[model samples]
Target chain A: MFYRTSGQFKTSYTADMALFPVRQDAILLAIILAFAWVILPLTASEFAFQTLLIPILIYSLAAMGLNILTGYAGQLSLGTAAFMGVGAYACYKLVTIMPWMNPVVAILLSGVFSAGVGVAFGIPSLRIKGFYLAIATLAAQFFLVWLFEKWAWLYNYNASGAIQVPTLQMFGVTVAGPTASSHVQYYVVLGIVSLMTILCINLTRGTLGRTWKATRDMDIAAELIGINLMKSKLTAFAISSYIVGVSGALFVFMWRGAAEPNLFDIPLSFRILFIAIIGGLGSILGNYLGAILIVGLPVILNTLPETFGIPISSATVEHLNIMIVGALIVFFLIIEPHGLARLWALIREKLVIWPFPH
Target chain B: MDFLNSLLVQPFADMFAAPDFLMQVLWEGLVSGILYALIALGFVLIFRSSRIFNFAQGIMVVFAALTLVGFHEMGVPAWISVILSLGVMFVLAVSIERVVLRPLVGQPDIILFMATIGITLFLIGFGELIFGGENKIMITEELGIPTGEFIFEPFGGFLLLEQKDVTAVVVAAVLVIALLAFLNKTRMGRAIRALGDDHQAALSVGISLQTIWVLVWFIAGIIALVTGIAWGARAGVSFALEVIAYKALPVLMLGGLESITGAIIGGLMIGLFEKLFEIYWGQPLLGGNTETWFAFVLALFVLLFRPQGLFGERIIERV
Candidate 1:
């Protein structure tokens, strides 16, 4: 079999404990990166770049951030979009106040703001746990969105009460704002998402990740084992919100172009939650898979009827998309509660052992 | 110092200066509290019986009302539509238990919670597809609910109350009494409580999980219907009503997820206090519309003191 690792002998613990113990995973990732960095940019149409490539990357990053907290750390937060809004608004203010600052730098620094806010909100986690903590996060969700709406300065006192991303250039190439081409924007999102993914992989595999998993699996036992529950939980929140905030900055500045306070409402939070859960909560690769299914599925579904000449209205298609996504979530949970990542692992395991009963 | 005075003293001063307005605000809060209580009642029933936080409770309210309205639109009599809607709810309960909850048995709590959210989305799309997304008025008169005003003189000023609000209160009170009776007096009700207490113990005692789950869900459906009627009568039925479900979460937080009385009192406290705070302080000071997060902030503060909620069972962790 292509995935057979029988000949790949580990001579030492270091060799055995490498991130990619199997040779094939590295090869597969290289292929995907090639497609993302080279093939996709060259072949994809404007529509595909905008709808599929850009959104999937951004959503995957967002889901990865959420996965860090809920899936890894065990603290459930329903206020991800609000944190993202914090990132978006923070970035907006940064670029506006210091017009000379690099947009990319603003995006990275925006995460700092969201990380701070997230830690502030995460304090309640020390007091509460489970569904109670989740609901407490909603206080942040509602309150922050309210603040976004009421505080005019966040949107730069725009007449429409919405934040607009200004045109920005990097190396004499437009990278953001309405005038920017999808091609440049897609590359920016792609680069950030890839960087975040690598960061998440190492973070989740290291001490912080283990601490989060320990905290998530059982806080009391983790504490008994000498883990600082407060530090572990707050750090999880900070890291998770930082990544989510950057994705949010990218979400609005690169993809959305403009955003109203309503964009950061509960539905958006649920949508990101859907991506994280459906992607396979604890798995890194599941974020991309979940984002593909959640973000890419609707576009495909919308186009399928038209391609087949079904003559259905767009409204019906939209409704059907919602129903299908909802049903798919339930279906995925019932069939494989660990999510798409586990499903892939199962498939890979089978592939590794094909034609052998044992 | 001025900011602190406005924050603390001005609200009280405003209330004293306009006692009639204060009475009106309190009355409004009480009515909304009843509605919130009704919705929280649905959540409590489902959560207690099956340990699933039924996010669909809010949509079920809209779905039930829509079905009744849809039936009436189809030329069915109001009373017949009511009966028919109940039948639909029963079918929904049974189908959900059979299709969604059956295979999902023994799953993690988070998974089950997500499944209910799935149900919410399904119901939203399904409801909208059938009934269209436009807002529909509840046939308040056809349903034979009073729709008038009752004014009184209090604090040497005129205080106004809606007759519909009075009816909502009366109906909610009766429903609570009847529900309490059913839980205390009926065999099925006792079985539901048994399941809530311990599933394995209840199963060992010959209680049927599927039957009790369906029954609890059906009761939740019934409560949804009542709530839909009450709230719809106030502000027409629409998908927008679904946001009220979020309101009930803070109620569950403050009241305890499993405590019915907690839901009631918590609902009343939130509804009243949010209103009082909004009218006196929020509108003048914070630009109004504070109802969204007031309940949640209050609940979070309360949770800081009582992690298990106001009346939730005490948590005892074991290693």
Candidate 2:
């Protein structure tokens, strides 16, 4: 069997500690990379790239950012959309102000602004815990959205009060704005997502991740053991915000193309939280799996009735879609509160011992 | 100097200059405060019994009102529609208890909270699919609630009070008193309080959790209907009313989650203060929509000082 580990043996501690301890995982990653990098872009249509691929990558990246704080660091934030808004608005201002700057650099740099804002809001987490802290984040959510609406300067005093992405070239290649092709945008999103995903995997597997798990499990005990609680929590916020901010920039510039302040409301935050929770919080791969399901489920449902030659209004389909998603959340939670990642792990376990009942 | 005066002195000066307008604002605040207390009371009852935050409480209001209006639209009499809506809510409570909450017993608090949000989304879709998303006018006149205005002349100044608001306050007060008596005097109410204190012990004492849960949720549903009618009367029934749920959260934070008295006092304080701040200070200095975050910000400040909230039981964590 492809997943069998019978012949593979780790001879050293380093070998055992390597990211893909099982040889099959590394090979699986290579195959996935091949599809993402080579096969999909070359074969898929513009609709597929726009509606599925690009959005999935961007959302996965955002969920990964949230997973760090809520999943790893034992902090709950319901204001992720506001942080994303900070990133998007910051990127918008950066490019508009410094038109000569590299678009990629502008997007990456936008995370710092969101990081600062994230830390400011995260201060309440030090004094509050659990749902109380979550509500504190809502204060940021509402206030920031209000700021986006009232502060004319954020949107450059645009007549419509929406941020419009302007055409920008990177090394003579159109990568963002209306003129950018879906293929180009998809690649940019894929590239940034992969880079961030690798960084997150490493950070989460290292010392900082261990510290976070300790803090999350029991902060008082973690403190007794000489862990610097403040440093751990704040660093979690800063890094989480940075990644989330970058994804926000990517969300707007690479995918949505235009956004209003209302776009970053509570519902958006809940969507991202859903991805984190449903995908299996604290797992890097879970973000992608979660994003795929959350983003792709509706699209598939929208087309299924048509493919079957059934007559259903689009509005009815939309309503059904919402109902199905809500039902699925409850179903998933009842069945596996740990999320789809755990489900995958179980399948992989069974696959490893397929021939034998044990 | 002028900026300082406008920020600090002028608002207070203006209040004294037109005492009648200030009185009207206070009256408006008290009415809204009472409504907020009603919503908070529903939350307190359910949280006390089940420890579920019930994020769906807001959507329940929308769904109940929609059901009432939908029934009337189908040619049912207004009073019958109200009764039928209560029946629908009862069915919803039983189904939710059986399908959702039963399997989720002993789950982490956040998981249960997430489940309620799931219920919220499901109801939104279900309600919209059945009744359509358009706003519907409340059957205020059909329900026999007066819609007239009362004008009071005092200090040689005119004060205006909407009769419906007066009706809302009186009805809410009566409902609260009735709810309090039911909880204190009834056997089932004591069972609910016992479950809130210690679920395992209550179960050991032969308390049927499923029955109590159904009852508690049914009561919450009834309260949701009243809130729906009162709020819908003010601003026609729509999914947009769901946003008011967020307003009750700060009240929960200020009052302890399990304390009914805390919920009522906290709700009134928030309702009154947020409006007062918005009119007197927020509009002039902060550009007016401060009502949005005012409650949350105040709650956060309160939480910083008293982490358990002003009325919540002390949190004792064990490692």
Candidate DockQ scores, in order: 0.85, 0.76
Local accuracy of candidate 1 as per-residue lDDT tens digits, A72-144: 9999899999999999999999989998888889899999999999999999999899999999999999999
lDDT of 1 at A213: 98
Per-candidate TM equals 0.99, 0.98
Winning model by lDDT: 1
Residue-level lDDT of model 2, residues B205-231, one tens digit each, is 999999999999999999999999999
Q: What are the clashing pairs of model 2? A: none
Lowest summed lDDT across 10 adjacent residues in model 2 chain A is found at: A349-358
**lDDT tens digits by residue: candidate 2, A152-197:** 9999998999999999999999988998999888888888889999
The parts of candidate 1 lying over 4 Å away from their true place are none
Docking quality (DockQ) of candidate 1: 0.85
**What total of clashing residue pairs does each candidate reach?**
0, 0
Query: Where's the lowest-lDDT run of ten residues in candidate 1 chain B?
Result: B159-168
Candidate 1 lands at a TM-score of 0.99
